[model samples]
Target: MAASHPLLAVRGLQAGYGRAQVLFDIGFEVHPGQVVTLLGRNGMGRSTTIKCLFGMLPVLGGHVEVRGRPVNGHASHRIAREGLSLVPEGRQIFTDLSVEENLVATARRPRTDDGRAPWTLERVYALWPRLKERRHNLGWQLSGGEQQMLAIGRALMTNPTLLVLDEATEGLAPVIRDEIWRTLATLKQEGLAQIVIDKNVKRLLPLADRHYVLEKGRVVWQGDSAALHAQPAIVQQYLGV
Candidate 1:
């Protein structure tokens, strides 16, 4: 079980690619077992924020702490070892590797001190049985949905403390999208902390505990589902209807 503090916290985060800054004063929190969403249209700073959080980009200012340990400017591999796992915007799976190999590549023992069980191939297969059926297929051979599932399973194999998804659902059939949402709900029930970025408000609203809406690389609004539901104007103004 998580302590009484946030699992991941970012305050006044600033980062970019060298001279061109894309994020400004970005901030958010994801407590243990909490589901948080970063919402915005394309070209916003959502993906940039994820990169900075995962140490893919350098932090220009502010603080980023995971479980009270400051990880600002840490190396990406170091950050991963510290328990932040990212499913990047593109499903960057190893195209040549088979499903089982991809999952086993990053597998690790859960670093949790609590009695929670660590994720294993058997558990991942249980979550997405389709992956088990396609265990021998190369990454490029799977459909978009199967690839997404593999990406997610590979992350779980890392036994991360916080799961950050850049684009939770972008391109997929309706059935696949629904399965992804259900998988997310199951992860939430299993006490996994998650930070999701996706455009499906109706689906996200119910699943997320809180939301941060960004525009022009800054967080414009932050609130819970009920608060967001109470203000449609904010959604239409910052995010499209």
Candidate 2:
């Protein structure tokens, strides 16, 4: 069972781009070592929530907390220091940097109080040997799959407590998608908490401990796998499953 206290919490979160409001009273919690997902169609404010959590967007109302500490208005770097790291929607890699440079660019040892082992450059290369093979290649030289792997490796180098992946497998080949899923499963087994957003509901159902389904920027449903399985109607209604 997971701990009672949440590792990351977002309550009444509201945000938007410019004068357009996209989120309404959005809320959720990610417990230690647990895997959760934000489920919704495009333009449903899923990415907006992620942006607010990382302080990339201003919060209209609400708060985000990490390990019981408030960090809603904090900068992205501050959020990373609080143990959150993100693999954004697109595999946005530094086009000019080599694979090794990308991995080390944002790498940092965890806070002394963090009990997990540090994620070193060597560790990331070991996790994806293709990265090691392409270590000297510029990001733009990599194939789509290789760039995705590099993106994930870069995030891992942050030594995060909770990893947030937005459209983690977007635009990847089926084989590469399988590889990404396998990596996430391995990370879960290693007890790294995660918040994932993906369109592949079938793939997510088995992996996520809990799910929050968003509709028009509100949480229409929140439940575990079993509960989700029991309510196929809700899945069809909001998720178009």
Candidate 3:
């Protein structure tokens, strides 16, 4: 089980590609078992935030804490070992690896006080039956949705305390998107904290307990789902296409 405090906390985070800053003092918190959505239109630094958290991009300022431990300066692999998992924007699975291989490649047994083990291959296959059917298929052989499922399953294999997903449902079919959302909901019930970045504001509203809106690399708005729904104009001003 996750600890009683926030699983992930990012404060005044500043990061970007060399000589090209993309995030400016961005901040958010994902409490234990809570689902938080990072909302914004394209080119709004949402992906940059994920990259910084995962150590893919260098941090120009601020701190990233996992379970109250500062991780902003850690190496990417070290961060992973510290219990942060990321399903990156492009579903970047190893194209040469098979479904089962992909899952096994990232599998790690987490030590929790509950004594319940982390995800097993059997459990992951059960959670995503389509993946079981495609167990032998290479990553390049699967469709977009299948690849997305594989990405998620691979992350779950890490048994992370915090899961960060960039573009969780971008360019997938409706059915596949629904599957991803349902899977996330189930993870929530299982007490997996997540930070989701996606464009489906309406759908994400219900899935996420709170919403953070980013604009030009800054968090311009933060509120609960109810507040967001009540102020569609805020969406229009900052997020409307």
How many clashes in each structure? 0, 0, 0
Q: Write the per-residue lDDT of candidate 2 for residues 20-120, one digit (tens) a residue.
A: 99999999999988999999888888998999999999999988888889997898998899888999988899989999999999998876545666899
Q: How close is candidate 2 to the true structure, as a TM-score?
A: 0.96
The number of residue pairs in model 1 that clash at the backbone is 0
lDDT by residue (1-241, candidate 3, tens digit) is 3347677889999987778888989998888778898888989998888888888888899999887899887899889987889998889999999999999997887846433357889989999999999999999999999999999999999988778898968899999999999999888888788889888888888878889999999999999999999999999999888
At residue 53, candidate 3 shows an lDDT of 85
Question: Where in model 1 is the C-alpha error above 4 Å?
Answer: 1-3
Tens digit of lDDT per residue, candidate 1, span 1-241? Answer: 3357789889999887868888999998888888999999988999888888988788999999988889998898888988888887778999999999999998888876645678999999999999999999999999999999999999999998789887858888899989999999988888888999998989999999999999988999999999999999988988895
- lDDT winner between 2 and 3, please give it: 2
Which lDDT values do the candidates have, in the order given?
A: 0.89, 0.91, 0.88
Q: Give the distance in Å from residue 12's predicted Cα in candidate 1 to where it truly belongs.
A: 1.0
In candidate 3, stretches whose alpha carbon ends up further than 4 angstroms from where it belongs are: 1-4, 114-117
Ranking by TM-score: 2, 1, 3
TM-score of each: 0.96, 0.96, 0.95
